[model samples]
Each structure stands twice: as C-alpha cells, then as structure tokens.
Target: MKTKDALYNYCLRLADSNMIHGQRLAEWCSRGPFLEEDIALSNMSLDMIGQAEMLYEYASTQSEAEHSADDLAFRRSEREYFNCLLVEQENGDFAQTMMKVFLYSAFAKQLYESLLNSNNETLSGFAAKAIKEVKYHLRHSSEWLIRFGNGTDESKRRVQQAVTNLWRFTQDMFEMNDADAALVDNGISFTTEALSAKWQLNVNEIFTAANINIPETNNTITGGYNGIHTEHLGVMLCEMQYLQRAYPDAKW
Candidate 1:
C-alpha cells in the first residue's frame, strides 16, 4: 500500500475503535449505577467520539475520493472497520464495563504516548491532546476495578470472571498488518508489538493494586484488524449507521 493509504488505515484503526467503544459507553447514559457516575460515563463517551471525529477527519484528507469524517464513520460496512475486537465486545455489566475500559485504556495510553514521537505532526499533536484524556480514562477505570476487587466477595468474583472472559481478547489489541508495517518503516508510527511488554507491566501493576489476578491463558484471539469481527460488530453498525444510511444527504 502507498504510505498515504497506510496512514489512512492507521487513522481508521484508531478512529473506529474510539467510535465503537464510545457507542458502548453511551449505552451507560441514564443507566449508570448513580447520577454522578452516569454523567461521567456520558462525558467519557463524548471524549471518545470527539477523538474519533478528529481522526476520521484526518483520515478523510488522505483518501483519493472526497469524503467527510461522517462519511467515513457512518457509510462504511462492518467488514471495512479495523478496530480491535476488545472494543467491540458487549458491556456485560458494570464490573465488565470497567474491566474493558481498564484494559483498553492501558493499551491506548501506551499507543498514544508513542505517538508523541511520531514523525507526523498531525498524529503527534493529536497524541499531545489525547494523552491527558486517556490518563483520566485509565485512572478512572483502575479505581473502579480496585473497588470491585476489594469490595464484597461477590464483587471480587464478578470482576475475576470479567478478567477471565476478557483476557482472550487482549491479544487483538496488538494485531498488525501491512498498514502498520508501512507506518513503522516511515517513522510515522511504532510497531504494536513493541508496546506489549510495557502494556503487560502496567496492567500487572494495576492488577496487583486491585488485588486482582491476571488470568493465566496461553490462548490468543485475533483478526479484528483484518475486519473479521465477532458477530457483535455487525449488529452495532446497524444502529450506528441507520440514520446516515437512510438519509444519505440529510442535514440538520
């Protein structure tokens, strides 16, 4: 692939994850455990969507055809998206949601931090702005995980179950293809493989503090980058794309 196409795919990978994950978080609105927490989730959802919009806009510019951010985000079929499988999984429960956030935020923080040194000024600038938000995301989710781990025996069991269930999907976060290779070679991005060790270390630290045990599993799941998603993503896009699909040129 050309370098421009590679960069465009990279942006879509980031943006698609944010858009889908944000959609999941939006499900928490008016449904949080409490009012304050509800508002917090909504705000975080907005943050994720905002970041996705920025990325989609940048990606749009790299395309040969004229397409806006909305077009890229809403007009694509489920198979065209390149987000990690971890972000597309259902938010099972409050504990499950927190666990998912902690895992993804840990990976995202590392990914964005690496972008600080990117040869592309646009990516580096986005990283500079996004790192602050990602830190808060990590911290918030970490605190919730700790609370769940240290609370009632029931809470501990639920969270432990979440860890086991979600652990398999973690490997998907590091999956890469030619787009990643091209970006790495051009100094516009680093290899996802390089982030694995540090991601594990950081995760171990948080798990230790939370009194949670990391699952011992050799099994790995992949293919989200190649757009071979679990069944959930197609169901999600139906709702997310409904308006745009129904009214291709409709405007407020």
Candidate 2:
C-alpha cells in the first residue's frame, strides 16, 4: 500500500511538472521572437501537455475519486502542485526563456533515461515515451542556447545573464523526499542523487559548446517539492485555474 501511494505521488509530481511547464510555454504561442521559434515552442508546449495527460491519467487510477487528468491539472490548489521551482520562474527575455528550456530539458532527459529502466512497468512505459519527446526538446533548446550565446554581443550578454540568474534555482530539481525514498527502495524510481551528477555533466557540455560559463553563485533557491513555491506560481495558478474556479463543473 505504501509503495502504491509513493508511486501515486511520484506520478502526480511528474504530471504537475509537465502541466505547469506546458502552460508556461504556451504563453509564448504568438510571442516568440520569430515565426520558426513560434511554431517550435508551441509544438513543445503540446508535447508537454500530452505527457501531462498520460501521467495524470496514471495518477487518477491510484485515487478513489473520479478526478480526470484535467481535474488533477486544472483544479489543484497551489499547495498541491509538486513541480520543481525552475518551471514556474518568470519567463524573462528570450535568452532567459531559452536558458530555462535548456536547463529543464537537460534534467528531464537524464531523468527519463534513468526512469526507462524502473521496476514499475507504468513508470518504465511513461519514461520510454517521454524520453523521445525530451530528446527533441533538448535539441531545440540546445540549438537556441548556442545561437544566443555565440550570436551578437547583445545576445551573448543577455543569454549569459540569463544563465547566471537561473542557475540558483537548479538545485531544487534534485530535491528528494519520503516518496522518493520509497520509490527508490522499491526500485520503481531513479534516484535524484544519481541523476544530479549526470545533469551537471550534460549542462556543462552544452555550456561549453555555447561558450557560456556556468555561474559562480553559491546561492541556491529551494522549496517547490514541499509545496513552497515562488510568487510567480500563484499568478500562474490564478491564470490556469481561473475558469475552473469561476465556472465550477461547467465542463464542455
């Protein structure tokens, strides 16, 4: 029973992460710096929303309530969200957005790779499907990172600053809790500790290729795992849950 609960929590975390990030990406729908990028980010947003649906569907199976994937995603309270802090951070400039995408895609790619071998069949299946999508996400983000980092002086300067600003929040992505412990013990989930090292290597490679240096800041902002998030998440939740809250049970 404990194992099942742990798995359920793990699934919700994954679902929330994708759902929140997808919604944020969708904000770039018509605002992308260029047409090609506009379509690209929109496509990524759709992929994340699709992945969130799969994860939330799996999570709903573990609950007694008849909550659908949309309910779990659109109806949850702010404190109920378990996504990492990185996803909720404000999309600053184009460089900032690219930095967010690069860092997150790198982490997700490594995590999904490890999860593909999880002992739990559901988790393994989800990871297998997500890995393919995240690979393209990584490629897209990496290409943009390189372009901005090595582009004109103003572009390079902005991307470099973006990288520095976002680095502090990266540590939260590896935070583990009791659910993670249980999942690790049951061999149903990969260890964040193990993934951290690989994530560093992956990010460093991209930074090197882009001729951008990882920031030297020692400050790390944590807390999204335990339900403590930034002010930005509240605004995001307000926008995301507005219709659901305003029109309770008014589904199409």
Tens digit of lDDT per residue, candidate 2, span 1-252?
Answer: 488787788888888888888988999999999999999999999999899999999999987678887789888888989999998998899889888988988899999999888988888898898989989999988998998888999989999999888899999999998888888888888678879999999888888988999888899999887788988998999998999889987868
Who wins the lDDT comparison? 1
TM-score of 1: 0.98
Off by over 4 Å in 1: none
Q: How many backbone clashes does candidate 2 have?
A: 0
**What lDDT is reached at residue 203 by model 1?**
91
RMSD of 2: 1.2
Candidate topping TM-score: 1
In model 1, which residue pairs have backbone atoms overlapping below 3 Å? none
lDDT of 1: 0.92
lDDT of 1 by residue, 11-93 (tens): 99999999999999999999999999999899889999999999999999999989899999999998999999998999998
**TM-score of each prediction:** 0.98, 0.97
Which parts of model 2 have CA positions greater than 4 angstroms off? none
Q: Compared to the true structure, candidate 2 yields what TM-score?
A: 0.97
